[model samples]
Target: MTRELTPKGSATRQRIIEGAAAEIREHGVAATTLDDVRTRTGTSKSQLFHYFPGGREELLLAVARYEAGRVLSDQQPQLSRLTSWRAWEEWRDVLIQRYRRQAWDCPLDAVVSQLGRSTPGAQAVLTELLNRWQGEIAAGVRAMQEQGEIDPGLDAGQAAAALLAGIQGGVVIMLSTGRLTHLEAALDVAIQHLRESRDRHPADH
Candidate 1:
């Protein structure tokens, strides 16, 4: 699971994943094909199989993983460097802008649902993504705690888990309704709750 990919191989695989994601986003997963991805990536059949031995299904899973990572990667530095109120404020804006623009695509839901939520690999990919995301949130929590800007009594892990759950729930609702209100509300309320927690112990913070 931890193979070292040569830079070229890594780049090629990324190209394939991005290509596949684009195809799926545009056509839906069931309608997209290996040939579509092949043409999109400019990859020959041999080159594609070389990177994904299990064929189209394997490649689909890979693309799913890539999209999942992207859900977090798009929020970087602001998400990772949450050391102050300013950083969280910036992150809040980024989060709003991200979903506001993508409200129509809902690519993650479109593709992942097509991949079958019951598949073990699919579930694992989602679980891993959530864990990494929560870890990032927890890291931000700890950063504020260490800076004496947040209450040490604040359970960072628990807080992060709850926040992630809220985000996921809000995202699901957004996809179902094609509205950003729930997503915006989730983030705003979550951050306000955290700020309230900090305010409760201002002498400590």
Candidate 2:
């Protein structure tokens, strides 16, 4: 079983994770070393081991989880407040701008790729992130349904899943081709479909 960390220990571990993430971002995951992370975080070798006894692989997984959280957190208040059409548009724009700014250098992708996606640890981290993301989007769709802005008959979870898949596909394409068009189209078309659903059930409204 894993031992629970005290507040200070937890803070130190998070600091190390953040510092390591920064080092990986600046130096690339393959080039980064535990010593580099130690220097960046101002932690001793023993101290580092105390937090991550599994060593580099363990630290990398922790960093992967942190970066995954960032993927959603980056969208912020807009992502959480998707109750209005305007709010959804804002969220979409934020998501687009985020990827546009990051371009090909995605920290989450880098870490996960380095960790090997098929690895159980990496798969768990990604699976959790996607599930959380889909849940939030489904909640937003249900909000629209409650407001009579979406077709009540439509399956919100399925719609959200489709949108999430499109977003992932768009991101992959953008990463490979360095073009944001696909991502933009994905977001626009998904949102358009949701909006058009209202027209499909005019009598229900």
Best by lDDT: 2
Query: Cα RMSDs of all predictions?
Result: 1.9, 0.9
- In candidate 1 the C-alpha lDDT for residue 64 amounts to 83
Q: For model 2, what is the alpha-carbon lDDT of residue 180? A: 95
Q: In candidate 1, which residue ranges exceed 4 Å CA deviation?
A: 1-6, 203-205
Q: How many clashes in each structure?
A: 0, 0
In terms of TM-score, the best-performing candidate is: 2
lDDT score at residue 178, model 2, on the 0-100 scale: 97
Q: Candidate 2: minimum summed lDDT over ten consecutive residues — where?
A: 196-205
Give the local distance difference test score of model 1: 0.85
lDDT of 1 by residue, 13-49 (tens): 9899999998998888888999999998899999999
Q: List the residue pairs that clash in candidate 2.
A: none
Q: Which residue ranges in model 2 land beyond 4 Å of their true spot?
A: 203-205
